[model samples]
Target: MLLLVSLFGCVAAVGAVGTHARLSPEAILPASAESVRAEAVLVSRFGAGEPHLMLLATTSGSVDGQRAATSGRDLTDRLAADPRTAWVRSYWPRHPAGLRTADRHRALILVRFRGDERASRAAGDDVVARYTGRAGPLRVSAAGTFAVLSESDRLSERGLHLAEIVAMPLVLLVLLWTFGSAVAALIPVAVGVLAVVSTTAFLRLLTEVTTVSAFALNITTALGFGLAVDYCLLLVSRFREELAREGSTGPAVRATLRTAGRAVAFSGAIVAVCLCTLFVLPLPLVRSIAYGGVAVVLASVAGVLLVVPALLVLLGERVNRLDVFVRLRPRKRTRSAEGAGAWYRLALWVTRRPAAVAVGVLLLLGLLAAPAALTRFGMYGDRLLPHFSPVARTSQEVRAAFAATVSDRPSVVLLGPGAARSAEAVDGFARRLSRVPGVRRVDTVTGAYRQGRRSALPPGPAERFTVGGATRLSVVPATGPAPQDGLTPEGSRLAARLRAVPAPVPVLVGGAGARLNDVEGVLADRLPPAVGFAASATFVLLLVFTRSLLIPVKALLLNALSLMATFGLLVAVFQEGWPAGVFFGPRGAGVTDVIAPLMFAVAFGLSMDYEMFLLSRIVEEHRRGASTPTAVATGLQHSGRLFTSAAVVFATVTASLALSDLLHLQVVGTGLAVAVLLDCTVIRALLVPALMQLVGRANWWLPGARTKDRGQERKTGRARTP
Candidate 1:
């Protein structure tokens, strides 16, 4: 009791420390990327790379009217006066006709902040809270890159908190239903709490060394609890079974540790190994999840091994004593026998129709996975916010009011050293850029050029382009409809076209399009290595554990199939916007988020974790000289209840995240839940058994194994060949 109490207390201390973990999440571009460098140059030179906040001033009359114009100017003046603001621009002063809505009742106010992202966001939040609602003659609202993101952060935090609150009681209920004893159910929940607390502390420590994503908090808690419960379920269930057979505590624990404990350890290791692949991703968001996932898995494993065994030792046979819900009590001997017999019968049934079962399951999985070929990967924008949110509503109104006249923010291009900065060079480059298909205007330090015609530099901020022996150009694209992913088509085309332009110096295009392009490229570039690393790691681990070549190959293939099917569902439901009622937020971006592949890897690894459990028992039985068919049947009978129960708990915890308003979090949560369910039911239950039946003795075949003469082996009293 003292030890358990001390351990729990330690976890609490660590969790408190963990609360200080900093979240320094980045956007599409890493700081070192060329696009980021271009953005940095612009921000340093011009005091603005992009508008941090876009305040919309709306009125019942034309924005050009005296009343609305005066109010708009007042709002801009107040915004510009804020110490946190670097500068502010509005239609009333500069381009009233150009910036006004077709309906003439709304205008945009673009504001830039004067510091690093963290400081700027902190200061921007203050500005947004103060200025978002109302002003004389005009109702003011805010939504831009920064305002939208800030709102998302708040919603994500709230959603994560809500998920935890809702998931815990449901998890407890599932545990109670599964174990039939309140004491048995409570033990896993306790282990889950310890895992979450310890992982939080560890992640906090990790933050001191490197950056962590705010999303990691959500991932850590969900995975920590789910994994802890899973490992504990395996341990407690096996311990109970041992007690039933041995009629004592110590020996039961020892036997359970030798078998079920070993399986839990391997499963935990596999999960950790799978998540490690995320480290290969260049994105901070993906890497943080990997770090949190691995830490949580380890914490859960440690809690199960250290804490659960102690609980088992203390409680002994009494682990089954508390049955608060009598109707949920464990089945009698006859029922237990029937379940095992049913699994055995089920395995035999699959064996008789192995070919048909294999073909049918594959066809269903293939059809389910077909939509994944159409998957589009991009960043989630303001569209992910709830439709009723202030930011979301404001953004929609702003788009409706001003989208037709809104000028495309020019893609800023940075020139490398030895680049020509002379008037002649600048003129020649500007003229060439203006000829690019979508180029509306090209502004250089020297002057602004449009359609190959040179105009003297405007009286405003054009000269800010020259700095540090390098020069920049704002290549504005012709105005039109932007792409659904938020990168305007002209901007996207302009970036590519600008890159292709032969310039004397090297060029780096930076803006929304460039940032997204870099992000997509990085994900694609890193995907092969990440997938290779995950697959190779899984193969090596399974090979060592099972010592069979075929088993690892089959497991990998099946895991891939289930994951592919899940991805298809995600693409169809989230990207294609199928059955749209439950999918809150904007219509799909016509693509999954860029991080979907990473989620697939993580899900596949988790699926393999359960595969390890099932195979461990089957392999054990095989080595004990049980025929391959009997070994497979007995192993399924032994592990089906535990694996199914664990899957339910894991799916429940992850599925809770779908309630998040952040579409990215929703994708992760919903996708993970679907993957786990598919693995538990279709893959583990049906496909795995059928595959094993078809494969027969080859499932356990290792290199250099002699084929026993059945009669000779039996006559010699040696272990029968599998």
Candidate 2:
């Protein structure tokens, strides 16, 4: 009753508080970064930079002509008339030729809203709901930064529902097949569902104290379902084993708790430690995922350890009732003991030629991991969506027609007080900025300069550049090939040059490119510390769990091998667009998303998860006085099936996520699925047994006080002095 009520409470709370979850791009950076500070200056001095909303107005005729111009004018005027907008600008009337498409049938309307990010998103959503679609001869659709973000949030919600609808039934069927009993199959699903609901409630509570990304929901569901099912499988399988031995529910539960429960606890702890390292990253998106990861792990642990065990105790022998798929396999094969199983035979075969097998597997992994050296990182824009999408089309249109417009969107340098105090100084700085390579133009309060020549200043607001006491220069990057993902080399180079130039006052370079550069910097700077801390935490956990110095180090090295191989495969398939016209398509960006590091974090944790399960069994066998080779083979036999099933289930869940229409989600799902599969098969099945054989007794060696004590015991056992 208590468990039932608690689950109900979680569901109820989720329904009540989930609405507060937000989608934000600002969540990617700190509010105090140089780019953020530049934005603050723009917002306070000029009503710019804060307006993230935009619209792409298209028509059948040339946007430069009078008809399309008039329609665009009317649309912009109407939008500007709204109380929410701080300002609105359109290319049709004043800058017709520059903003129109090459075919001349499309134009852009840039709109800025009043207030902070949340308020602006709300206003933008309202505007989009009200004004998008046909208007006069022009068709207006919501596009640009906020539009893409809003649409992504909508798709995330729908995709979560779709993943659940598709994954749940498939998981149930797989579990039924694995267990061969309807009653046993349903238990893990129940625990998974409970964990998901409970995690949603936890995220809702987290939102009250700090900003939680809507993106977190997707991760929460994935982690919750995958880990919950894994934990339940471990517990249920162990419970059945104990039941066979003890012949009663009570002793079986006790023994299962003692062995499998400890493994589950350590597994969860290791994964949790690995994920918690994300907190060391400076981005809110990573931190939010960390929050979600930790919450779901804890929830899954509770459901499996507390709820499933109690229910098992009540069900007793009936836990295996309602046999289904009974005749799917031969009884002898299905009910094989540890040493009699397929994995045991395979382990024995591999151990016979341990050195050769280990060397071959290592060579294969090395080749697979080689491509990761050429991996490029970048933020994914609308390129993640199909080119047919309105958001994606608008992005392409903007890149084509108005690539060099001196709007608030371009790379900018904000000069502090007295940097460009005089008109001559401002003009000289503008000329110097234009001379820099990769800079298409520089726009300042005085005039716009292209290729070191000042262009005629059109009549407009002079205060746009000169705000408060500081002067701003908008530096347009020369149009070029698209970046791999988030990297904008040209923009980054321009920003760097602008900063290096001598100035009378302090200068802060900012914009999309600079902001992305800062994001990359934050990751690079924090990576060493984050990795060190996570490794230390994982090592401590493994040391306590295995009580062997060499084993934990071997485990870490094995995880690294699998992870590097996974990364290499990802780079080849996703970044280089291998088998291009099929899996990724022509629209493939030919680069990995900036979020690939996050995938590595999650995959590494999952690798440790399987590692813990396999090692725990091997350590147990070794402690029981078995020789090293015998323990390795027996451990593989006992634990290989368990880890394999968990991997299949986990891979199934994550692969289902890959079926999402969203590209980033697809990357996440595929990356994790591939990592889990490799970890289970190549690493666990072949490499682990072979490597353990090669190491022999040294695999269980412990150093320091324990080693000295063991040495003394060995000496005292045979008294040659007597």
Candidate 3:
């Protein structure tokens, strides 16, 4: 309680001070256009121009029109003090509706730099120092698109809190329902709490080396709480069954330690491995997500193994009391009659009906996934904020006023030295860029130079055109904020166009477009490799664990089938033009993210946890030489309840994640929810044994004569050499 209070207090202080979280400049400021090739383009576009760059600060908010507008006078006075600051402006209106228009509160401060690059940067530093906190309480905040999004830090924070508030009770309900004891719930929840703290401390330290995203809190909390809960639930349920059978918590814990503990260890390792695959994408957001996920998984494992068990040892009977369901007492252990004869009945049924179930599941997912195909993609980052938000207003206005042409987008280009900074050089380069399609507008600082245009100069960074006497030009294409996935056709076109630039100057085009292009390129390039990694490794591990080549192969094939169905569904809802506002909630008519595939791949493997756990006992029984049908029946009987419970745990976490306003959250939440639902109901329970029965001995095949070396060499006792 003390710690919770302290943490909340800190969050409140930061929120009150208004800088606990801030948007990354990259996320907020528009990316350089797809057309830009040279940094000079950025330098020229708004750099040397009549100072289009401005910092409009208000020590006030929307609450009071009179008092906030009055700050404009104080702002004007401060502006008058600095000679280098010219045309410093602020739009403070006395009436609420007056300043509420698109243009209000966004002011431009025209700067006069005294010297060169060093001087200008120094001046910028001074500008920040002078203006940053000059105003008092209810102080000045930033106003550019990025600045506006930074302010939405509060909203994202609120989102995380909301997800937790809604998710926890449901999980507790599941725990209570599972254990029939209030005390048992603490084991998992406690472990999760510890995970949360340890991860926060680690992340807090990591913040010193590098910045953490605003989503860090949400990520850690979700994962920490999720893993703790799931791992604990898995272990606790097993431990309870052991206790009921043995009539002693000690023996129960030991059996659980040997059995469920082993399963937890295996699942934890896989989840960690799967989450680590996220790093394969090589993006900051992805890396952060990986870090957060790994921490959470570890925390969950730790909670289940170390903390929950330890607590169980400490307070065995007492833990049961907090549980409400126990008071009711069941006459006997709950078991469904249908599930009783399930293994043989299910096996025979499935061997009879695999195609029907497969078709049904595919058709269902196909219907859900149809929304993503015909979709277009765009991110209204801060626009997702409510109408009351100031940042939302700021973003709306800038986008409204700015040039809609692709050339006007903020972009950067890379070019070598010793190039011409003249109209002839620039026009030749412009013609080259102009020819390649997707090149909306190409403006060479050199062309601006020869034409004697200077208003665009300061903003344009024109003079930097000649690096070592060779000229470089920056191109700007007008576009909305670039896509995060970076693999879209737009990203592809930008890269192709940059290569197509016929510049004697030797140019490398990039900025927002190229950067995103690179991101998309890496994703496309690496996804295959990651899939190979997962497939080969899973096959090897499953083969060794199950000692059945056919089972492993079939397992992987089934997993792949489920994943494809998931992707199809993702494409349907996010990529195709479906009004996702119904289920996934509030999404526009567009396809989902490029990274969605990778995320699903990694997450699907994790989602496969229940399947692996449910099948392990059955497969082990099969290795002991039971008939496939008998083994399937026995395995489902023992594992079915846990499978149902685990799926519920996964779904709860997923639903919580879905509640986050971020699209990334929505993608993960949706994929996980659908995949888990399918894995539990359609894949694990029915598909495994059916497929196994169909293949029989082939399921345990080994290659070549070497197969004789792997399994018990069946003597000539069964049959003489044919």
Candidate 4:
């Protein structure tokens, strides 16, 4: 009853808070008056189209997604009633479209706004008031990328219910089929589910301060289902072996807990640690992942270490055996999923020649990753929605029409302060900027300066007043064919020239383009740390698991190769735009964004997960006095097929996310799927075995370093020495 009450409390709190915060842009952005330019620049270029960001809020489903969206719409209608809002109305949709995913209770509505943040947010707040409860029992609010930063938190909330409904059954059925058991197999999962559900409720408390992205739904669900299923599988499989020997559930469960449980606890700790690395950056998105990751992992550990044993105590003999899958196959064949015995022989050949296998695998990854190099890092927003999407189509038309009216298309701001109200100072700066080559036009406060529109944000005196008031001058660059952020030489050149401005006015430049440039810088600075930290941690985890420092180092080295080769290829393909978007699937990138490093790091971390999982069994056999060759063969035979299936599952789910209308998610999902499939097949099967074989025992031994430790084998023989 207490548990039930707690659950009810959580649900109630989520609804109460969720309604006001879902998909709220106000939640995510660093709100400062000075930061308004980041929001304003786009509004200036897009005109009324800038308000389109609000659509993400409307579409996000919470207690009142529809009602909140309706409020935004109604406010828009009122705003349209004024002459000043005539242009804003042009971009406003009477009723925005809402997205319906697997569940219909959820939905999304799209909208647009004007100016930068000031104009847009002022408008957004009006829409928000109607949806923020107080009006009635229903608190209406949208949640998504732009509408809510807390969208992630809402997504976390969404996943809480989803874990029980979707993931639980799915995990149960999958485990039942995999284990062919009743209580023995399902008990661990039951424990894991309860623990994770409880932990997620705790996660809600975090929403008070930190922003959570909706994507966290995937994170927790994946962690909960994955760690639960994996732990239970390992424990129960061990129990089955022990049960046949001890002929008792209590002893078998105890034995399984002693061994597999220890491994699970250690492994879960490492994974939890690994995930915490995401918090190395100051970015809230990554930090949110850390919090969510830690909670689920801790829950998983608790389930495996505590709950499973309790379950065993309760269920007693019933927990010892079963037939969930009703299979007629012999039990011996069941233990070995892949044809790994044969592959083991193949691994021997590669062990004899590590360089050849390593090189071959590197070549393949290099080729596949080639497209990533030429990829452009663009925002995967509604803007990238199919050219036919209402907003996309509208934007295209708007862009074309504006091209005729304005001298410049949507572009950049290269800013510096100017000298007084002197027309000469503004004129000289404009003349120099106009001659800066890539610049289309350089407008100043001077009467002679012309293109269109009078200057409210003019140069000289206006710029001076701005400086005294913590404001600065802005020089808008031509849209042209330049890279989105300052990635290219042209962008670099523009930035450099603007920074060289001689006027006394203080200069601080930012826009979508500039912030994006900063985003890249942040990634570059943080990625190396992430790589070194994650890789070192992985190595330590493997070392402890195998009790062989060399083996862990080899794995680390191979992971490095896979990661770097992929990065090189990403640069070659995505950054360079090789094959011009063919490899990228439908939408082509001209130049990849800085987000790639973070994404790549994340992909590599997950790839490490499969590597650790599939290979641990083989390493275990080898440690138990099986010949290295025999161990490889037996281990692969046991876990190979399962690894492949899991990889495919991960890939398939990730692929589904790619189908999202949002380009950002689509790009992320695409890259993740590619990495997983590659790791599972080429990296896991062929290259890893081949490389390990070539290294022989050296794969698990550091050169010039050998402790005469217990269970030490001098060579590859079956004999072990203490």
Summed backbone clashes in each candidate are: 0, 5, 63, 56
Look at candidate 4 and tell me the lDDT of residue 409: 19
Candidate 2, residue 232: Cα displacement in angstroms equals: 1.3
In angstroms, the error of model 2 at 175 is 1.0
Candidate lDDT (C-alpha), each: 0.77, 0.76, 0.56, 0.53
- The per-residue C-alpha lDDT of model 1 at residue 66 equals 82
lDDT of 1 by residue, 1-722 (tens): 63865667586665557353266645335678767787787777656577788888888988888887788878878887889888777886665564677787778888889877778888888888988787887888888888887898889889878998998788878888888788888887777777777777777777777777777777787777777767777888889878888988999999999988888888888888888988877777788888888988887888788888888999988788777678644556574464356667787788789889999999999999999988765656676777778898887776666654333354555465444357577778878888888777787866888888887664245456766656777776665565222353334455667777777666667776676677767777887887888788888888878878898999999998998999998888888887656665446645566666677756776798789768977887776678877788888887777788888998998999888877787888999999999998888888998998899888877766424434445566765554
TM-score of each: 0.91, 0.91, 0.74, 0.71
Which structure is stronger by lDDT: 2 or 3?
2
- Per-residue lDDT tens digits for candidate 4, residues 350-433, read 566668877887877766555544445543332334443344543343333333321111232324333434556555554555
In candidate 2, what are the lDDT values of residues 562-626, reduced to their tens digit?
Answer: 98998888888777777656875664565566667676777888788888778877877665556
Residue 404 C-alpha lDDT in model 3? 35
Candidate 3: which stretches are off by over 4 Å? 1-143, 247-251, 312-323, 327-330, 333-352, 366-390, 404-417, 420-426, 446-488, 506-508, 574-577, 581-591, 596-598, 660-662, 702-722
Considering TM-score, which of the candidate structures 1 and 3 is the better prediction for this target? 1
Better candidate number, 1 or 3, judged by lDDT = 1
For candidate 4, give the lDDT of residue 346.
62
* Winner by lDDT: 1
Supply the TM-score for candidate 4.
0.71
In angstroms, how far off is 607's CA in candidate 4? 2.8
